[model samples]
Target: MEDKRNIQIIEWEHLDKKKFYVFGVAMTMMIRVSVYPFTLIRTRLQVQKGKSLYHGTFDAFIKILRADGVTGLYRGFLVNTFTLISGQCYVTTYELTRKFVADYSQSNTVKSLVAGGSASLVAQSITVPIDVVSQHLMMQRKGERMGRFQVRGSPEGRGVVAFGQTKDIIRQILRADGLRGFYRGYVASLLTYIPNSAVWWPFYHFYAEQISYLCPTECPHIVFQAVSGPLAAATASVLTNPMDVIRTRVQVEGKSSIILTFRQLMAEEGPWGLMKGLSARIISATPSSIVIVVGYESLKKLSLRPELVDSRHCYQRFTDCYKRLYQLQPEMTQRIYDKFITQLQTSVREEISEIKAEGNLEAVLNALDKIVEDRKDQEEPAWRPSGNPEADLRSALVPYFRQQRDALQRHVRKQEAENRRLAEAVVAGRQQVQELQRRGQARQQAWQALHREQKELVAVLGEPE
Candidate 1:
């Protein structure tokens, strides 16, 4: 349930390379195999001449089914699965190379070119034979030709194709053309894939970004990928369609050598002959590209869990990003980490109260603990404790944050001490005032007594009056 996007860093050492290679390849194979029938049908339509073998895509499908059954539609499935190795090679190379490039330069255009070129080069080397054989199977007919299939199409173009068993096809290709036969159209295949791949990636990225810009703020990311994926694929398909035709013709059994095949197509069909199946290529390739990109991204979201990335390794990447960034941009510093410390201080200060304050450090220490957790997501420390900066910052800042509680307690104690002195002063002043009042009362009484006595003396002296 952990959000994978927020997982900022993943160390190369921590990643299980083999596991992902297998998974990526296997998943890609599943999707490709599911869509193989359409591919086979498209290839069949492309290989036909003038009037063509069948009227359209559906007619071709119906004809192949009526003549060869369900298994006929999936003619080269076994050999095609061999392409899985190439798929894995492509994905793994791209991921490793792209990460390496992205770390050095922030430009996506550069990263896409480097990653795409390197990946295509490596994968094509392994998959060229598989492609040749698979195309042969896709074009391969079901029944043995007796020079009588003119009723349908060319007789020499196909023979009985033994499906299900890939080894048989391998042996057959070997008997006919030896080791070199496997790489029949290697150069053409490379020409078709390498540049197209290099261009497709950048095209996809560019279009995706453009679409995202045009879209409203609430538009989903998948929508951008969806629109960009097919458009990029269709463009690349058109540009590379000629190379694809050459690769296919050269790869087919009994076809002339690569150069001879190019000449034959040119001499027989003219300049546009190389772009024979442009429509088929676009139709098949666009959806394939879309599904692969979207599916791969979705799978990555599922697999690259924050919990699985090993937070211990993520700490180093998180730190390294800053190190690399600051080295280039000297003015920048780690403000987020500082923000984390500030938030902790504020949160802890709010908890420091007269009621919560105690002689023991329990309340203050508890507040410090809460601050560590409260600021963890903001700072994004290790998910599983990898000697992260959060722990170190906690150790360093506990005392500083504790100052809030300490200052509060000190103010409270000062107020209490002053209150004691004020009470003592008030009591002493009250006693002094009481004593003065008593003296005044005593003096008044004495005066009264004296006055009474004087009155008595006056009375005694009254005889003279």
Candidate 2:
């Protein structure tokens, strides 16, 4: 009887940091490896000029496989994997920033948007350089030509020797444009990813909320998240694709500025060029987003502190009861339920702290009694007769409270029975111990008597004749 609406989001404070980081990095690395081929194809598609090298996404994959083999699909995998460091930074910043912003805002959308943007900004400092190098590496295909553009080989006349070494790429970049070459598309990357993150998170939350509401109550929260993630990513990819195109071009093609790249793209390739790699980006992003979101949610669940997991289950059960009570009489019961929940939560938290400090079950019982008494006192006035006879609220509430009371009484009876059984078991254990002790004493006495008998017989035998 679990309620889908009762799904608790594990927050930053509740996480085991060591587990989160270790699992997060491993999951992100696997996701990147899985989707990197599509990324390579997308980058290649974005950088191509008029009279395109490949007709579409499938065509690009086939041509790369035929021309350069499977390695062509993973050209920059090493450089790309290095971005896991930046991924950690992004996740940390996002979680911390979201927690901070949550104190001021009630809207999940606003919190996600701000947190996403801040995280992207922080992550880009590390990621932009890796992106610059990786995108260049992605472009190094043997005998690939796009209209008038041709891929250059090494001075040694070997494409593999030229593109295979990271040092050579760094040296070439240094020789061409100096240190700034490592950050060729710095502004464009920010423009692309910051907004993408900002938009994607809000949309993700929105879609998840909507989908969860529309789906049956038995549907799991993870299902909602799985469906929402790809939709949000596809939307973001399409929205910010022009900037992504510009960023890739600036980094790989060594364009001077974002504006210049845009001007040239428009002049040479027309408005449709803005969406050159749209299909590839969407194709890569959808499955990548699904894996990332699902993995992240699973990581949070796995990384939750042991104590919080119990508390989360307790809270969910409480929420289910609250939902049932609210459904009894929607208008009046809501107010009572809200007030009760607030007071109950506060009382429970205080009682838990006391229990942890003092290890006192009496304090917990007393706290529960006080909460129930206080709620009864507050709700007594509402139970009084209203002016209308047919539209009475009391009729609806009476049965629910009576049902709750019966259930509580049954639970108490069950607990008392269990306690009696435990007491009887303890008494039986003591009796068993006592019986063993008596047997040991009798055996010792018998052994002493036998020794005495043997000594007397020796005496009677006259000292061995």
Candidate 2 lDDT, 115-196, residue by residue in tens? 9999999999999999877777777777453312244565755344244456667778888889998888898999999999
Candidate 1: C-alpha lDDT: 0.69
TM-score of 2: 0.69
Instruction: Give the alpha carbon lDDT tens digit for every residue of 244-340 in model 1.
Output: 8777767764565778877877887788777666665676676677775686665564456455654444433544544544345322223344455
Clashes of each: 0, 0
What lDDT does each candidate get? 0.69, 0.80
Q: Which has the greatest TM-score? A: 2
Instruction: Point out the worst 10-residue segment of candidate 2 by lDDT.
Output: 379-388
Best lDDT among the predictions, by candidate number: 2
TM-score against truth, every candidate? 0.62, 0.69
